[model samples]
Target: MDPLYLGAIVAIATILVLFSGVSVGLGLLIVSGGFLVIFDGMRSLELMPEILFGKLDNFALLSIPMFIIMGSSISSTRAGADLYEALERWLTRIPGGLVISNLGACALFAAMSGSSPATCAAIGKMGIPEMRKRGYPDGVAAGSIAAGGTLGILIPPSVTMIVYGIATETSIGRLFLAGVIPGLLLVGLFMAWSLYATWKSGDPNLLNGRSYTWRERFEVLPRVLPFLAIILGVLYAMYGGIATPSETAAVGALLCLIIAVVIYKLWHPRDLWVVLRDSTRESVMILFIIAAAGVFSYMLSSLYITQSIAEWIGTLEVNRWVLMGAVNVFLLIAGFFLPPVAVILMAAPILLPIIITAGFDPIWFAVILTINMEIGLISPPVGLNLYVISGIAPDISLKTILLGSLPYVACMVLAIVLLCLFPGLATWLPDAVMGARL
Candidate 1:
């Protein structure tokens, strides 16, 4: 059989398995192993153990668990609420201030957590009700947090960026820095839309908000500032060349635990155990997927499927931007069904070379891919953030949430276009700070 046809089969089979509600890691393992046995025989199965172990053995991959622990520790405490309240106090007087504050909280929490679902669950639980209590529309109330939560994958300390970095052999720190400007850009776009929507509606209740005293604004700072400090510390350590990603993550995780215990008094053994257990579950799931994806990539390579695809792409005479548009569309479709990490593990490798050959920077493309994933978070079928908002605000219908998110989705596409025009938004910070990488 032609390797291209086999590639199609693998693609279709993987999509079918994942959409059929199979666990991501287990599903990938099944697809890869079955293909290996059928095409390469039982003898090829021997390499599976080595590939799995070898993939997990990556030094940088160690950061994944630590980062997960950091997020778990924070979410287990009152940090998310405090963060939102702090922002709400500062932004209270502006039109659509409640929604704007929710987005600000999401971006800040994303820096701390790096997991979209965690960001949505924590901030949405607090932000949604507060916004609704203040007369914010249900769609805007729910949509804002859902959109904001997608920031988790684009900000520094992001798990998705870490996964992308390791998968592509790009510098994790560079990728982290790469995301900073674009992440902020996306937040700006979201808040701008919220402000415009509310102002344009001319609803006095949504336009005018409660005022907070200076002291009230300052109240939650003590609790929230430490988490912000951790985000800055992680970025500084990694970008300043003071630590590798794993080292920064290890220290960041420790700092988060200390802050959680000190500020929130969650020092009980049971609380600590819950944090550990949660992080362990998430970390294991990610690592298992990475290992499985390693074998999957290996199978594609062994079968010449990946190489053939690359060669086929090289022969295309289309404009570079056209190719990029097509790639983004493919990524969007894939992300609508699969989570960001799985999508990155499965697709980034295959696309990186094609992107570079087309005269695009890999780091800039990482930002693009991330924005696509962000769009997916609010999109349907597997819109995890949408479901998260649904759980947080049971009264709000999913259809309304999705409808509300459409504007923000447009914002994301706009961000992608802006990045394509500037490119520097994703690359400048990293290059400025670290010097250019080969």
Candidate 2:
């Protein structure tokens, strides 16, 4: 049996199973196991343990749970409300002020927690209702938080970056630094678009927000200082060589607990248990997907499928720019149906090599991939963030949320193009800061 034929069959089977409503992890495992048995017999079954363990046996991968826990702990506290309140006071005077404040809160939350859904849940719970009560459009309010929540994966402490780095053997620290600029760029673009949208819609309520006095703005500062300190501390420790990515994660988690218990005093003893339980559940789901994707990835390598595809791509003689554009388009389409992690897990093995061969920097490609995942998180059909926002604001129709996300999705696509054109946007900071270390 030809490998290409087998690969074709596996691809078709995955689509069928996934579309049939099987979960992504189970679907991948089922398809991969079937192909493995057919091609390599029962002897290959024994290698499953090794493949699973090998994938999980990474120091950087440990950070996923830690980051998730920190985010969960924060969500369990009043920090989300505090962060939104603080930002709202300062931002309301600007056009589309509430929306801008929501984006700002989402960015700050993303920096603390690397999970997209977590960011959406925290800020959307607070922002959406407040925006709605202020007479903001439901779609626009929900969309702002949905799209902004994607920053959880693009900003530092991003689980997506950690997974990508561990899977590809890229430097996790450098990947973290690389995301900083692009993340800031996306934040700016999203806010700018929100202002334009508000202005164009001629919604006076959205634009004519009250301004906070300097004293009022400073009064809310204490509410956010604790989380802000931890974020800065983690980045500084990592960049200063005081800690590895995994260690930074550990420290961040500890600091979040301290802030929750000591400073905020908002976390009850029972809340700690809940946070742990929820974080563990989310982490297990992610690891299960990683394990499944690992086996699938191994099967791709053993069958030489990825190499064959890369070779075929090389022979096309297409300009690198054209190939890059095509790859972005394909990823954008894939984002609509698949969760970001699964997309990276399954596609990175096949796509990263091709991008590297085409003279693109892997770190830069990592940023580009992260941004693409951001767009997918809000896309329709199966965008996880859209559902997250919907879950938080049950009254906000899914259609309204999706409609609002379209503009932010456009902003994400623009950010991707900008990163592609000026690779330095993603690479320059890491190059300068990490220098020889990177």
Candidate 3:
């Protein structure tokens, strides 16, 4: 059978099964199993267990659960509300102050936590009500949290980056450094849009914010100081060659546990138990999808589908920039349905070679791709962050949140353009700090 025709049939079948409401992990497993039986014979089933186990047995991959636990420890405690209070005190004097504070707070939290939904759940639990109390529009309040939460994947220590690096054999440390500038750029863009929208709304109600006294602002710092120290410590330890990414995660997780128990008084056995249980559940789910993706990728390799696709792309007559633009547009559309991890698993294998052939730096492209995934998290309909915020604040309609998030989406698009035009935005820091990659 022709590989192209077989690939089409497999793709269509997978889509049909996914649309039928099966869970993503189950859907992927089912589709991959079918492909194995049909394309490689039933004998291929014998290697399935080994393949799945091999996928999860990586040193860097271990960092995932540790980071999740660290994030969950903060989430399960009062750190989120305290962080919000600290930012709110400083940001409220300006128009759209609460909304700006929400964005800032999410960015800060993203530095500590690497998952989008985790960031949303932690901060949205406190940010939404405060925004409502400040007289901001419903759409803007929900939209900012949803959009800001997407930063979790773009910032350093991102789980998505870890998956991408392992999948494509890119350096995880370089990928972390690569994301820093673009992530900060998105932060600036989101804040700018928040300021503009608030001013344009012309709501006198929004102008009624009361500023915190200087002493009050200083007092709230201790609440967030420990978390901030963890973020800096992890990043520095990784960058300074003091520890590997996985080791840094372990140390960070240990410190977070200490803070939760010692400072937050979560010393009760039940409280500690809940954090471990919840973090483990979330970690297992993610690692399972990753394992399933590995088996599926092997099947794609067996059929030579990835190579065929890359070859077909290489034959195109268009310029590299034009091809990249088309790829970005396709990813944006695909983001509407697929989550970032699945998207990276399915597309990175096929796309990375074509990108390398075009003479683009893989680390730089990693940053660009990470930014696209950031936008995906906030895209309407199936964007995970949108549903997450809605769950947190049931009163806000999905449509209102989607509409409010559109402006931040534009900000993300601008960041993509800037990164594309000047690749250094993603590459320079990693090169300057880490020295040139071989």
Candidate 4:
């Protein structure tokens, strides 16, 4: 069989398997193995163990599971709830205060969790109910939660960034550092959009005036400050070279455990076992996906698909910016049909090469790619965040959630444009800290 034909068939089969609701890892494994056998015979099976082992053996990959454990432990502790409550008291004087505070809380939670679904589950449960109780429109409540959930991918400890760093052989520490400014920028954009939406809608739900006294505001701060301190400590230690990314993650996980058990008193002794069990389950799922993606990527490389795609893209006479725009459009469409992780897995090998060929910084492009994925999470038909929000707020119709998310999506696009125009927004901190290390 022609290699191109084999590639086409494998791609189609992989998509069909995914759409059929098979687990992505299983789908990739099956499709890659089947293709390899058909094209290269039974001996190709020998490659599977090596591919899986090579993918999993990376020391950098250790950070992924540790971060997963950290996120789950933190979520189980209800630390996010306390942080949201504290933010609510402090922000009540502003218009659309609860919604603003929701974004703020999501950003704070994003610092710890780094997984979109986890962030949504953590903040949405608390924010949605509070927004509703405060008389905010259901659409507004749903939209805010959905939008806020995306912050997880943009912030530090982000699984997506780790995956990008590993995929491209970029510095994980630099990638994490690069995300901080853009993440904060997006959070600010979300808050501003919420304020503008409230102003335009004349929504009575927004709290106005300086209602909370200084004493009351200060009282709530103590509950949330420790989480912030932990986050800062992790980033500081990593930046200061006191820890590698994996070590930082381990320390973060340990601190999360201590916080859950001692400070919040939310996790019972029995719950520790549950957290470990859940973490193990989730980590296994992630690792399997990574390993499968590795095999699929290997198959692509063997077929010279990456080289062909890069050469084909290089032939296009368009300016680099135009090419990036095209890539963004392609990613947006792909995001609608594919899961973010799956999209990243499939696209990174192809796109990273093109990006490097185009002379763009991989770290900056990673941040940009992540923002696009965040937008994809809220996109119509297959937006995972929309479904997550709708699942929790079943009373709100999908159309309403879709419509409510439009403004936030627009803000994400704007954020992307800003990052493109000002690459320094993503690159500055990484350069200042990592210097020539990148």
Q: How well does model 2 score by local distance difference test? A: 0.85
lDDT of 1 at 357: 77
TM-score, one value per model? 0.97, 0.94, 0.95, 0.94
Better of 1 and 2 by lDDT: 1
lDDT of 4 at 271: 89
Pairs of colliding residues, candidate 2:
none
After superposing candidate 3 on the true structure, give the runs of residues whose Cα lies further than 4 Å from its correct spot: 204-208
Off by over 4 Å in 4: 1-6, 203-210
What TM value does model 3 have?
A: 0.95
Off by over 4 Å in 1: none
1-438: candidate 1 lDDT, tens digit per residue: 898798999999988988788888888888989998999899998999999889988899999999999999998988999999998889888767788889999999888988888889999998888878877777788888899999989988889999999889998888988999999999999999888877776678887678999999997899999989998998888877798899999999999999999999998999999999999999999999898889888988888888888888889889989999999999999889888999999997679878887888999999999999999999998899999899988889999999989999999999999999999999999999989877
lDDT per residue for candidate 2 within 1-438, as digits (tens), equals 566676687778888988899888888888887778887897988998798778887777888999898888788777878899998998888778888889999999888877678778888888888888888777778888998888988898888888888778899989999999999999999889877876777768888687778999989888798888988998999999998888998989988988888867755778788989999998998898898899999988887887888887888889999999988888888888888888888888889889988988989999888888788889877789888888998887888888989988889889987887788999899989989542
**Candidate 4 residue-wise lDDT, 1-438, digit = tens:** 555565667778887988898898988888888877877789999989999878988999889889888888788877788878778888877777888888998888877877677778788888998787767777778887898888888799788888888877889898998999999898898888777776776756465633777888888776677777888998899899898989998988888888778877755768898889988998888788888999989878877767777887788788999999998998888888876677788888889989988878888988888888888889877788898888887888999999988888988899889988999999999889878542
Error of 1 at 258 (Å): 0.8
Candidate achieving higher lDDT, 3 or 4: 3
User: In terms of TM-score, which candidate is stronger, 1 or 3?
Assistant: 1
Looking at model 1, residue 154 earns an lDDT score of 91
Model 3 error, position 160 (Å): 0.9
Worst 10 residues of 2 by lDDT: 1-10
The model with the greatest lDDT is: 1
- Give the CA lDDT, 0 to 100, for residue 321 in model 1: 91
